[model samples]
Target: MTSSRSETAYQRAVAAFKNPTLDLLHRRYAPFVVSVLSVMFTAERPTVPISDAHVEVGTFVEELRAAGYDLDERTLPNGTGRDICRSWARVGWLVPQITDGVELYRLSAQAVGALEVAGRAGGGRAKVSRSRVRTLLESVEQLTQSAETDPALRLARLRDERAALDAEIALIEAAGDELDPIDDDQLLEDTENVLHLSRELPADFVRVAESINAMQRDVIAELRRDERPAGEVLREYLHRGEHVMEATPEGRAFAGALKLIGDPEHIDHLTDQLQALLGKSFAHLMTPEQRGELRAIAKRVEQGVQEVLQAQRRASHVITTQVRTHDPIRDREVDELLRSVMSGLQAWVPDSRAGDRIDPLRSLPTAGVRHLRQTVSDPRPPTAPAPLRDPGEQAEFVDADTRAWGGPNYAELEAYLAGLEAESFDLAAAFAGIGDAETRRPADLLGLLEIAHRNGLVESAEVSVVEALRPDGTARRFAFGAVTARTLKVESHD
Candidate 1:
């Protein structure tokens, strides 16, 4: 019988598989049996070994066993081999040709195609031929027939077909360097719709669309810069439109300025010059309160600068004097002693008389010694004897007893006390003549007090004592006990 075109291909594929160089083994079963088995294998049959005819028989029996067929391999006339042959014939891997009581089996042509395709698919040294395609198509046809009632299977098949068509279209387009006109029209329509939507949208949406339009325009302009005949000027127009849509008044002004000042480096300098000119020309442009506030701030800054310079000068003088001085310790001792004595007198004297009597004589050693003996003796150590005096002397005295008992040790003590007396006398005279003497300004007294305090001649309290003297003639008393000479010196100065 003359073979159909597909049948011819199948025969050719089978012939290739049978070639010695290909090394594909098939059973020496009947041609019909072999062909049937081959077609089944090609149709996605489970994997199995293909040997000679008896080997195929063996494989058939095993498959029967796997499929729960209850035939006994050993009990058959030809053992499992004949049973496999029987099973193959039953399952149509083989077909039986019977005459009278005798039966013969032949391989099926479909089975031959199946075996050839299966061998090639499994890397079995056989190349796929035109016959394999026909076999695969035949198998697909059979599957479609079998799954006709399954919606999911039908959908999967349709999807696979659509994917294949899509891939084919893509390959054709790529090769021809031509896009589909339909897709191009669709894209143009999409672009127009997007623009329309952007125009009709809410403010925030319009802003986002404007930004996207700007980006698109920028991209197009950059592409155009490559000298390609593209929509460069159109893109710039689009960008301008986006800017107009999105810009605030300040943004517009800034944009105008940026256009005017094209050079970024000079822009800052230009801005500064403009600001200065504006400030000069528009001084009246500011409100009265605003101008007042500005002036106040300027005044405060000026005052602050003056204060800083003054403090610096004072500090420099202090440091220089400190460096030049022989004994800071001696000065401190004198100031403390003076302050101590003055504080004592301030405590004992009435407020009215306190300023007149105590204030005037505070820095005098005579006044200090008298005040100390009278007011500050209580807290002195018992071991410290009273300041001694001459037997006939009426004034408060500093003899052996007084020297021993007065706060610190004697030799050091008398020296500090004497220093205190001298400082106090000078300070008292200075204070008393403040208004009368050109050199004796209240500022001079304050400067002296500041120096005395800075030099550690007296505690800060003693300086406050002077301030409390208050040319108004009221005395201010503060607590002190066993005071140092530094405090006494401060009191004397006050």
Candidate 2:
């Protein structure tokens, strides 16, 4: 290679390694970061509530410290998990978001990329496997066939594929009763290849979503700046917003993925195939985590797609709304006023001294009124406070009686709910599972209802009864529509 070309290539390599994704992999605590992230985020969960994440991270730090890891302030951050997470956000490894008024932490595209790299390194697979080579060959052949302009060549290729299919079908029919299934080795190779490819989808989806977000922010910033004509800005942003999936290489890959598995049928087909694969004897060779990942692949893809779609919709909505509500004149006036104030401050700062005192205005300038009407009502007591009742006349009640009449035992109920392992269960069943008599009262039932509502439980149209015994030894059956609590899997660093 020429000297100039060599220099150019070296510069490009340097630039590539300098990105946040590579920086994350090259950091001193890379393994720690990647391992914690992998444990906290999974296919079933992509976002964690900030508070839970902070607490989990804090616990992990303390555990590690107890295990004698040097986590000094100089080597590793010494503050709480909240501080660590905040540092990550500042550095673009974690993105903090608010969904439905709850603060959540999501892995950034760069962090996702770093985690992918770490996962691939730990997978212990050869860089080039038989299945991977076969996939590449098939892809190249398909591409060549599609690119062929000559009718004769295309027809020949089609005829060859048809003949091969027919031969395979004939062979299968002839050996129907004595057919040999694929060996475990080949099945394992193919499954691993599928997993390697499937695992890449999350990173790609995150990258695409982040790209859309960046574009949205850029569009908004440009609009607020009022530097360009409204017509031009609107047209440009509208087109970009509508076709955001074509704007970047990652976006195009996302578009391709959407085309491949956008349909519910395609996703169902994928799930069915995974189930069939797991049913095979070769599946025993795979680890439990691998099997779980395969089972949840469809759900992961569906959720990822939904997230990207939501991001796109939000971007489009924000752009359209900004355009619709945009007032260029008002914006310009505000901008000018801010500039004037800043210019005055800049001019005054040079002549000002730190110790100089200035009068402070404590309140806003009053609006003067010439006439005022004063209205007053008679301060007489209304009906003499209904004569105080005698303490003797009040019904005597003990602590136990008051407790029975009080609200539900929310803390105890919450602890019970947390201890359950089921993904979902009927309200009646959960109530029945309570072993403590005090926890099975009517108040506890009401507490369960409140907890369920807070957790967004599903209510059924069919009625379900939960019988409760009060402290007074009286039993009462309360009838309400059935409710189901669907427990979400908590992603923790434990």
Candidate 3:
């Protein structure tokens, strides 16, 4: 007769989400909120404590400025950035954490859902990867019911799979029994799928941590309630929270992610295969910078996961301490003391202080609409807030890669090495010609040695000096030595 709990929940969720003003957040406050979150969520490690909040705000403002935001860092109110954090908290996208009377702010579980929606809705603006479909298919195949419980359905599915397998086997076992290996096209798609999944590891871990944090709060609240002894409640919720973290959907997903990141061999293999794939057919799919990111992604993902796991450990200790000293003796003592005090108060008498009051009820106004004082005052029109307008700046956010990829990579350096033909290598002169001075530090003299070793072209070498161009369009000189060509090789455009 009544709507189901889930349906009721859906209705409540819809009502809660249907706020006109709140919906405008993405438009009005998105530049600040999204940029900060973009960095906060994706940053390798962020500790935005109250101690650093002031400085962090200024740093973020500077970053935005570098990104061409026209807003003045100085003009921003002392408390302007903190207000956004508070606003997010009010909107349920952030949770303010407290530990031992200290406060910390973090993203709520819902924030991930919001970010995911934004990413799906073209906010990310990344190409719709070919790997997505493969990911979906693989997910379905892996997650489908197993043979243990749904034997009949499993049998049917297995039979269908067997049919497909048989077809493949037949093709392979035919006349010559030669099986066609997955070719470049399949390899491209497979590499993409792997990269896509690997890239998602950090974000997935962040969201899982968010979810676990939500559960931990719930557990703490349940344990702190006076309905039962604190120890019992704490113990119960601790076990439950641990189980949920270890066994539930988010937990399992996190565990799987951890497994992928935690295995050094797997990471090494993935990196090597990815590098190999990138140098081949998949090369065109990604930038040199992106390739670099994929190569180093495993360590970053592992660090994020470890941070989350460490947080869980800290939370466990916090919950234990919260209920460790709950004693029924102290509770009963307080209760009996309260009862005795109440009995004494009941038995004792007090002098009346009510004798001095005038007729309070009679002094009040009895008129419904008449005899009330009326006053009129001049009214002025409400003034709107001053419009904030600075033509938004357009400078780009620069990073190490921006500086590195600005000029060249090892490949380019090697090419430059081959291009030298004055009977010996000229490291500085070659790099100078290629405008790679600022890109590769002048102090990195070891690069010349590396190039020779890699190509096995150094039968002899010596330190030499030359000048190169800086990004500021100035020439700077450096000494990086030279190497003789051991093998006969010419500069190939390839």
Model 1 residue 256 lDDT score: 45
lDDT against the true structure, each candidate: 0.43, 0.85, 0.59
Give the clashing pairs for model 3: 68-393, 68-394, 463-481, 464-481
lDDT per residue for candidate 3 within 1-494, as digits (tens), equals 99999999999988876643235344445546555665665434333454345356557866666776656553322345566566667776556666456666655545544544454453344445556776777677867754247778888888998999999777777836365555665665565456555654555566666666666777666654456656576677767766765766767778776676667677677667756766785467665645655666666666667757866876677667755755557766877888997886566535325554334445656567756568877586589678988642643665523443243355555655565566555444544565455445443335545665665654336776766544555666765446454322555576
TM-score of each predicted structure versus truth: 0.14, 0.70, 0.48
**Candidate 1's C-alpha lDDT?**
0.43
By TM-score, highest first, what's the ranking?
Answer: 2, 3, 1
Task: Give a tens-digit lDDT track for model 2, residues 364-478.
Answer: 7898999787987879976667876767446677643465567788778888887789888789989988998888999899888888787779887999987898877788899
TM-score of 1: 0.14
| Among all candidates shown, the one with the greatest lDDT | 2
> What's the lDDT for residue 221 in model 3?
67
Candidate 1 lDDT, 37-70, residue by residue in tens: 5433321222233334456666664565567643
User: By TM-score, is 2 or 3 better?
Assistant: 2
Error at 182, model 3, angstroms: 7.2
